[model samples]
Target: MSLSFASSPFSVVCSEVSFAWPDGTTVLDGLDAAFGTGRTGLIGVNGSGKSTLLALIAGELSPASGTVGVAGEIGYLPQNLPLGTARTVSDLLGISATRSALHAIERGEATEENFTAVGEDWDVEERARAELDRLGLDGLGLDRTVATLSGGEAVMVGLAAQLLARPDVLLLDEPTNNLDLDARRRLYEAVSSWPGVLIVVSHDRELLDLVDEIADLREGGVRSFGGNLSAYEELLAVEREAAERAVRVAGSDMRRQKRELEEAHVKLARRVRYGDKMYEQKREPKVIMQERKRQAQVSAGKHRLMHEDRLSDARERLSEAEEAVRADAEIRVRLPATEVPAGRTVLTVNGLPAQQPASLEELIVRGPERIALTGPNGSGKTTFLRSLLGEGPEGLQVKIGVEGVRYLPQRLDVLDDRLSVVDNVRAFAPSASVNTVRAGLARFLFRGRRAEQPAGTLSGGERFRAVLAALMLAEPAPQLLMLDEPTNNLDMASARRLSEALEAYQGALIVVSHDVPFLRTIGITRWLHLDRDTGLTEIEPM
Candidate 1:
């Protein structure tokens, strides 16, 4: 049956929406949501159907048994963009056809087909160019090929296409995943100034902070919370505190009920003994004794039943209290073996040659210094990391003070997909027994059968944890860990868990990430920005 939230003043609506993957993993089940004017930030754990719901609203996917309603034209930008190299900027902007028709007419070939194509969109190119300029693609030509654009630029272009369309409703899924600081700011500006119904699905704290409201998709439904990310977090904290208090109170009640039940049993046994003694003493007449015994049995049954029912109710209450409490897991227990001495040089970088206009030079990392590498896209962040680690098949020349260096690239392709997570870690640490690997995996939230599952079958968060376990549990023990965009595809929960795991890393760290809030949480001792002219230089926190 079709459904609509009566209080919703939204342009986009989903009514009793249900969807499932080909593998039979149910995502949205009879979900109802509405997005009105202004910015709505859709936040949820990974695989909670946020993307699918957006897709359904965009008409990319059909609901199995429900209706999705959009008031006007819709625009959707998915997490993974279409990266076709053959397409030009005009084509990507979705105005290539109209622009061609207009150009043909300009050349005096005024065909009926051209006029039909142009229709009422004579100013489409101008509008597209204006949107591009607004989104920080000022000098980028319309004729430029899509293949030449960086990841950030591509995202901006995609967004510009949507703006050019001027759709009444817009959907963006993980729009800022691979974006750098500059591109993110541009996108944030666009979001802030949006005039129509816009729904953005992202885990970026900064981006979410700009939304007018937060729509949390959890456990197959939408929960609307007024205000931004910080506000939602504040409200959640208060609710959780209250829930935790309830749990404590319920536990006490449960213990009291249990004690009372035991006391009732003891009192009943004592009464029974007294009654039996009286009967054995033959103090009462035969008829009276029989009547008394019968009454005692009935009273005992009633008392036992009453106590049992009270205990059962207490247990049910305790279970409900526990369920109300959040159980977000934490990563733990990095060995002291991974620790780097304060005075000992863990890494000495003489110079890093970049393909850009500038070059990176000298640094002496002598302790557990947490350094954050930040830059705009295509500024040689990944190139510099590969140079330092001597990765790639070419094996670039590099020097290091320690042999314990480990690099976690953005793609996380370090695992053997065919092997189980346990085997992957075991491959890294040959000397460690199966039991040791299992124990380490447990710390990363991979327990029992999960550890035994093939790496390819794991979800995004699970795969991240597995890769992390292997890196930390390696043979030499990474004293100098280098991570490149570690939080790229992770949801908030996974990202939080990752931060918790990194909290225990005693080794020196040099991670490349655009997540400013996350960098702050990892206790960054240094911040370096890659510039086209200045190269890699130390900078104060943003």
Candidate 2:
């Protein structure tokens, strides 16, 4: 597959770009890639430098070597929105000055500076509002502070700001990270209808399915596939099949070459034996016999060397073919210890929040029910989980019946940063020996030395595995597992692995997330919606 799109007038190009962290960790080295005027989905495993490449293209970070050339203006929305507590929606939209100037002109204070600030954006407020509405943020007024908005609202507002800029190139990093189902749908619509160069770094499959191309970054380079993610996956499936076949063929060839080399050695030995017999029989003069023996040895050496070279070439080809097969390890662990009986009362809670439905005032969970807690940002979904775990605010009253409930918060703050992965797991599974903890962690993909790496030094995906290992491998085994937005920072493969791990968890689960697809994958048996307007209520799965 090609590593770049077809060049165009408005293409963005990186020529031999190299970037490294302050710690001298190399990300992109001598990477040459181009993105033309179309929607491109940039995907890679965690730590493959997709976000770093986006930053370089957006000019948020400078390349240590080489240059980035863009033919038009660029608007970038990073993975995290750095919204200040005091910043307002207008400030986030990047139209604070224009809105203020327009208001000043409306009040008959049309100063020259105000006119310059407004410029041709006299309808900036209307446009901003339109962009907000397009992204399902219309209800959030422009005057409201960003700190009061939910996490999804802030992300949508940031994206709205970028859209309002009307730049030629739009760059979005994990744009659907915290967005709910409706918000994601809106964002997907926007992505599908985008007219200019759109480069989005996301693990959301639905969002990636709308792209014009897939740019897979691995080993410090990008490989461009001609279609969306689904098509790209299909192509990968075919390639892997072909690669596996090639490996089998190469293995056979290698074995055949080895056998041929052995046969040639045997044949050469037989010729030597025959020559020895001839010499012993005095079939030729002594000098002529010696010369003939030397000639025979030289010919035998040439034959052996040719066979050896063939065997070596076959081995090399086999090695190369083996390299073509991908080996992305997955989390596959059994959790029979977490199982709860059908008649068991895993959890029971009393006293719902104010204005909540009276029917939900006293809730009970029996056996191994999987409940999906979903709501818009700031709808108290996380609060509800915390309150159920008896970690909420002082004024709220909550009662829990479960004793061994484990909560995996959205931030994944369960691990000590200074501790090693094995140590972190052992912290929870105290009764487990170091070797036992290491054995458990290997199931979570932190095998051997990886389990010794400090939590602070781990990458996003690695940190998640460490946290999961610590939680699931705890002593006594949790019968009720609660997770809040667990897949927010995960890549697609990691998210799938999380689902796989959760599938093996035989317990009552309460997961607070906006990821409906992921919720379905883990076999959520019940769905609950917590909303400021509707309180907490059960609903059908989407």
Highest TM-score scorer: 2
- The models' CA-based lDDT, in order, is 0.81, 0.83
Residue pairs with backbone atoms closer than 3 Å in model 1 (clashes): 10-36
Q: Candidate 1: lDDT over CA atoms?
A: 0.81
Model 2, 381: alpha-carbon shift in Å? 1.6
Give the local distance difference test score of model 2: 0.83
Q: Write the per-residue lDDT of candidate 1 for residues 1-542, one digit (tens) a residue.
A: 24354655778878889987554556789999888888999987755678788888988888998889887778999866777889999988888899999999999989999999999999887888899898878878898998777667788899999888778898998888768877889898888888998999888888899999999988888999889999999999998899899889889988998999899899989888888888899998978987888898889889989989988998898889898886655555364367777888877766444535544467677788899989887667777787787653253445577767888876577999899889999999999999988998888777776677777655455566778788888978788889988886577777876786687778889989888888988889888888666777778886
Candidate 1 Cα misplacement greater than 4 A, ranges: 1-8, 100-111, 329-337, 341-360, 363-367, 389-397, 411-477
Q: List the residue pairs that clash in candidate 2.
A: none
Candidate 2 residue-pair clash tally: 0
Candidate 2 positional error at 16, Å: 1.5
Candidate 2 residue-wise lDDT, 299-357, digit = tens: 99999999999999999999999999966556655554767888888777665654644
